[model samples]
Target chain A: MTEPKTAIAIQGLEKVYPGGFRALQPIDLEIYQGEIFALLGPNGAGKTTLINAVCGIVNLSAGQITVNGFDHCTQYRQARSCIGLVPQELTTDAFETVWNTVSFSRGLFGKSANPALIESILKRLSLWDKKDNQIRMLSGGMKRRVMIAKALSHEPQVLFLDEPTAGVDVELRKSMWDQVHELRETGVTIILTTHYIEEAEEMADRVGVIHKGKLLLVEEKNKLMKQLGKKEMVFELQHPLETVPPELCGKNISLAAGGSQLVFTYDTLQEDNGVTDVLDCLKAHHILYRDISTRQSSLEEIFVDLVRAS
Target chain B: MNFQGIKAIYRFEMSRTFRTLGQSIASPVLSTVLYFVVFGSAIGSRINDINGVSYGAFIVPGLIMMTVLSQSVANASFGIYFPRFAGTIYELLSAPLSFVEVLMGYVGAAATKSFVIGIIILFTAGFFVPLEVKHPIWMVAFLALTCVTFSLLGFIIGIWADGFEKLQLIPLLVITPLAFLGGSFYSIDMLPELWRKISLANPVVYLISGFRWSFYEHSDVHLSVSIAMIALFLTVGFAIIAWIFKTGYRLKN
Candidate 1:
C-alpha cells in the first residue's frame, strides 16, 4: 500500500547547544495526517527539545523538518503558519485580555480578523467567561485553556501540544481530551508529548516512546499491548503456609508473603499450558487457594518496563 | 516582516504597556515633573543664560531628551527582557512573526513610550520656564528621530541583556552618564580644550545638539553636522539590531 500523506515530517533532526550539550540525536519520524500521535518519554528525554526545534523556537544543529510540505527552515513562515504550538510553560502576556490575546495570536499567523471565529474558539475552550479578564488573573488551568485557545485561534492544520494537560485537573483533562477528539474529527493532526501515560493510553491513536534521545518504539497501542502484554496470576491461600511444597517446585510458581500466597507469571499470547499446569501442580501438591485473580500489564507497566530495559 | 504580524505584536505589546497606566504613563509623567522642579529651579539659579537663553530654558531640551532616552531604553529592554524571563518568548518564537516583525513591535512600542514621555517632560518643563519653538517642525522631527534612535538602541540592549540587572546596567552605567556629560546642562564649549574634545566623543552630544538646534536655531555643534551624526548613529544602531534579530543572538539556542 502507498504510504499515507504526512502532516509533519522530521528527518535526521538534531540539536546541540553552544556549550556542546547534545539534547537530541538525529531522529526520523512521520506523523500521519489527522491522527493523534502521542510522544511518550521520561523527563530529560529531549521531548521538549524536539518540539521546540520543530516549531522553530530552537535552532537545529542539523535536520530537515517539514510541516505540511513546507520546510521548517526555508519556508518557515509557511511552515509555522500551517502549525500551531501550545507550549509547555504557562506563559502568556500577563496584561493582555484573553479575548485580545487569542485574537491577536490568530492575526499573528496572518489570519484576517474574525471575531466570530475567535469567540467560538474561546467558547469551546471555556474561556468566553474570562474573555475580558487579564491573563494574569486567570487560574492555572484557565491559563492553560487560554494557551489552547490561542493555539487554535489560527485554525492550523497541525497542532503541537507540549504537555497540554500537565497540571490540569481531571475534569478539565477529560474535557480537553474531548476537545482533542473534536479537533481530530475536524481533520487537525495533533501531536502531543505527555507525562501521563494513561492519557496516552486513552487518547493516542499511536504511541511513540523516546528514551535517552532515541526513539525506542512507535506502534499502535492495542498492537503493542497484544504483542508485549504479560499476565500474572496470584492465588490467595485459605490458610498461611510455611513453604511451597516440593511437588510444585518444577512449575514456574513461587511462594509469597511467607508462603501464604502463590504467584505465577506467564505470557498472555501463549495458547496453552499456563493456568492448567499451574493448577494441576497446585492440586498435586494439595495446595488450596481461597481466590485467584489475573492481571495483565497496563500501559503504565509497559512504559516503566520499556524505560527500565532501555 | 508580515505587516499583519507586526500589527498584532505591536498592539499586544502596547496593550501590556498601557494596561498598567499608573506605572507606564503616570509615574513617568510624575518623575519628569520632579526632575523639572529639582533641576530646573535649583540649577537654573546657579547659572546665567546659556547661548542667550535662560539656563532653565537651555536645559529644557536636554531634560526632555534625557527622559526620552532613559524611558525609551528602559521600555524596550524590559519589554523584551520580561518576556524572556517569564519564558513567554517561546510563544513569540514559535509564532509566524518574522524577526523584523518582532523588532518593529518591540521598538515601535518603546519609541511610543519615549515619545509620550518626551512630550510629558516638555509640557512639564513649560510650567517651570518659558520656552520658544524657533522651528516647530524641526523640533518635532528631532524629537521623533531621537526617540526612534534610542528605542532601536534599547532593542539591541534588550536582546543582549541576560537579566534585569544587566538590562539596567547599560541605561544607568553607560547611557545616563554619557547623556549627563554630553552638555545636557551646559555647552561643551564651556569646558577646557581637552574636556571638550573628550565630550565630542560622546555620541549623545550629537543627539542633544541636534535637538537643541531645532529649538533655539543655534547650538554648540553645527546643525548639519548634528543631523549627519544622528543619521549615522541611527544607521549603525539599526544595522546592529537587524543583525542581532537576523542571527537570533542571545535569543535562540
Candidate 2:
C-alpha cells in the first residue's frame, strides 16, 4: 500500500545526556495522521525523554524531528504551534483560576482568545463548574484534567500524552480515554506513552515498544498480536493420573492440577498443530476428558516477553 | 516578537504579585516608613547639610535607591525562580514563545513593580521630609533605568540559583552590602581620603550619585560617568541574558 500521510516523523533521533548517559539510541519512526499510536515502555525506558525532546523541553543531541510539515528546530515556532504536550508532571500555577490558566495557555501559542471554544473544552472535560476555582484547590484528578484542557486550548494538530493515565483512578481513566477518543474524532493525531499494555491494547491502532533507550519494534496492533500470539488448549481429564502417559511425554504438553488437567501449547502461526494426533494418542491411551478450552496470549505477556529479550 | 505570548506571561506574573499584596507591596512600604522615622529623625538632627542640601533630603535618593535596588532584584528573582521551582517552566519552554519574548515579559513586570514601589516610597518620604526635584525628568529617568537594570540582574540570579538559599545569596550578601557602602545612608565625600577612593569601586555609587544629581545637581561623581555606568551595567545584563538563552543554560536539559 502507498505510505500514509505522516503527522510526526523522527529520523535518527538520539539523546546523550551530559553525564555520559545514553538516554536514547538512534530511533526512526513515523506516526500517521489521524491515528492513535501508543508508545509502550517500562519505567526509565527513555519514553518521557523522547517526548520531552520532541516538545523542546530537552535539547536533542542528534537527529531531526518534523511535526506535520514543520522542522522542530529550524521552524521551531510553527512546529511547536502544531503540537500540544500533556506532560507527565502535574505542574500548574497554583494561584491561577482554571479558566485563566487554560486561556493563558492558548495565548502562549500566539492564538487569539476564543472564549466560546474554551468554554466548550471546559464543559467537555467536566471542568466548567470548577473554572473559577484555583488550580491548587482541585483534586489530583481535576488538576490532571486542567492539564489536558491547557494542552488542548491551543487547538494543536498533534497531541502527545506522556503517561496520561498515570496516578489516575480507574473511573477518571475511563473518562479521559473517552475524551481522547472524542479528540481523535476531530482528526487530531494522538501519541501516548504508557506502561499499561492493556491501555495500548484497548485504544491503539498501532503500538511501538521501547526498552533500554531503544525502540524494539513498531507495528500495527492487530498484526503484532496475530504474528506473536500463541494459543493453549487445556483438557480436564475425567480421572486423575499419577504421571503423564509415556506416549505423550515428548510432546509440547504438561500435566498439572495433580494430573487432573493437561495443557498443550502451540504457535498460532503453525498449520500442523498436532491436535488430531494428540487426540488419537489420548484415545489409544484410554484417556478421557470432561471439558476443553483454548486461550490466546495477551498483549501484556507479549510486552513482558519483548522487554525480557532486550 | 510574540506579543500575545508575552502579554499572557506578563499578566500572569502581575496577577501573582497582586494576589500577595501583604508580602509584595504592603511590607516594603511599611519598612520604608520605619526607615524614615528612625533615620530621618534620629540622624538628621546630628548631621548638618551636605553640598547645600539638607541631610534628610540628600538621603532621599539614596534610600529610594536602596529600596528599589534590593526590591527589584528580589521581586524579579522570585518571579522567575518560583516557576522553575514549581516545574511550571516546562509549559513555557514548550510553548511557541521565543526566549527574548519570555525575558521581556518577566523583566518588564518586575521593573514595573519596583518603579511603582519606588514612587510610593518617594511620596511617603515627603510626609516627613521636604524634598525637591531639580530636574524632574532626570529623576524619573534614573529611577526607571535603575529599576530595569537591577530587575535584569535579578533575572540572571534567578536562573543561576538552583535553590531557595542561593536565590537570596547575591541580593543579601552582595548587592545589599554594596548599596550600603555605596553611599545610600552616607556620602562617600564624608569618608576619609583612603576610604573615599575605596568607595568609588562600588557600582551602586554611580547609580546613587547619578540619581542624587537629578534631585539637587550635586553628585559625588560627574553626571556623565553615572549615566555611562548605568548604560554599561544595562548592556552587561542584556548580554548575559542573551547568552543564557542562546546556550540554553539552566533552561533546557
Over the stretch A92-164, how does candidate 2's per-residue lDDT look in tens digits?
9998999999999998888889999899999999999999999989999999999999999999999999889
After TM-score superposition, what is the CA distance of residue A78 in candidate 2 from its true location, in Å? 0.4
Provide the RMSD of all predictions against the true structure, rounded to 1 decimal. Answer: 2.3, 1.6
- The models' CA-based lDDT, in order, is 0.86, 0.91
Q: Is the docking of candidate 2 incorrect, acceptable, medium or high quality?
A: high
Cα deviation in Å at residue A151, candidate 2?
0.3
List each candidate's DockQ score: 0.69, 0.83
lDDT of 1 by residue, A1-310 (tens): 9777899999999888888988888899999999999999999999988889888888888879999999998899999998888999998888778999888888788888899999999888888989999899999999999989988989999999999999999999999999999999999999999999989989988889898788888888888877777788999998887876777766677888787888888887778847898888778777788999988888888888999999
Q: Flag clash pairs in model 2.
A: none
Best of the candidates, lDDT: 2
